[model samples]
Target: MMTTMIRVVLPAHLRTLARVESEVRLDVPLDAEGRLTQRAILDALEARYPMLRGTIRDHVTQQRRSFLRFFACAEDLSLEPPDAPLPDAVASGAEPFFVVGAIAGG
Candidate 1:
């Protein structure tokens, strides 16, 4: 197994909740057959920062929170399958995975 560094950007509220001022850097474990996906990233994020465990995803179902959105390489990844491999740029750390808070108003 090997570890790869992944960069992540959290929304302001989440950052405050996690007590982080800058982008988060996580060392994600990768096996020979493991593909870099949203599920993998979220698992690593919650593992490294337990405070964020249920913040981004449901603890039981592991589903993304409804009020949050995900993005990578300037594309909306919110509706993508969690197990699908993220963009290469994101997996390579060339682009940061983004979690943004969604706001709805009339």
Candidate 2:
């Protein structure tokens, strides 16, 4: 199995929960087809920071939380499928995957 070092930037609240002050670095394993997806990243993240399990995604369904959004290379990836491959920049650690807290209506 091939692994890639992915850089993930978490929101302040989640950073506090995970006791991390800056961006997180995770070693994520690529799928059989050599694809690096959000699921792979999140799985590695949760495994390293168990406290963030339900904060980013539902514990049971493993779905993204409604109040959060995903972005990479200035593009919104929240609507993308979990199994979809991420941008090469993200996979190559050139760009960080951002987990931003969504802002709501006033």
Candidate 3:
């Protein structure tokens, strides 16, 4: 299995939950087509940090949590297809994938 190291920045709460102080570097595996996707990144993250398995996405439905958002290269990727390839900057490590916890108040 071929793999690439990806940089990911988690929200403060998640960072605390994962016990990581800085951005996380994960060895994400490529799919059968030799392409990396958001699903692959999230899968590798959960695999490496078991505690984050269901925190970012639903364990059963695999849907991103409503309170969470994903971004890369200054673009919002929260609604992007899971199989879609991330931006070249993100794939090449020029930018870090951001997992942000949304805040709402009135």
**Tens digits of per-residue lDDT for model 2 on 37-67?**
9999999999999999999999999889999
Q: How does each model score on TM-score?
A: 0.89, 0.95, 0.93
Model 1 residue runs over 4 Å out of place are none
Candidate 3: residue pairs that collide: none
Model 3, clash count? 0
Please give the distance, in angstroms, between residue 72's alpha carbon in candidate 2 and its true position after superposition: 0.2
Q: Please, what are the lDDT tens digits per residue for candidate 3 over residues 1-106?
A: 8887879999998899999988999888877877779999999899899999999999999999999999998899999999998886776777999999888762
Candidate 3 displacement at residue 17 in angstroms? 0.7
Off by over 4 Å in 3: none
lDDT of 3: 0.90
Residues 1-106 of candidate 1 have per-residue lDDT tens digits of 7767889999987788889988999887664665577888888988777899889988888888898899999999999998777887887789999998887661
**Judged by TM-score, which candidate is best?**
2
**Which residue pairs show backbone clashes in model 2?**
none
Flag regions of model 2 displaced more than 4 Å. Answer: none
- Give the whole-model CA lDDT for all candidates, comma-separated: 0.85, 0.95, 0.90
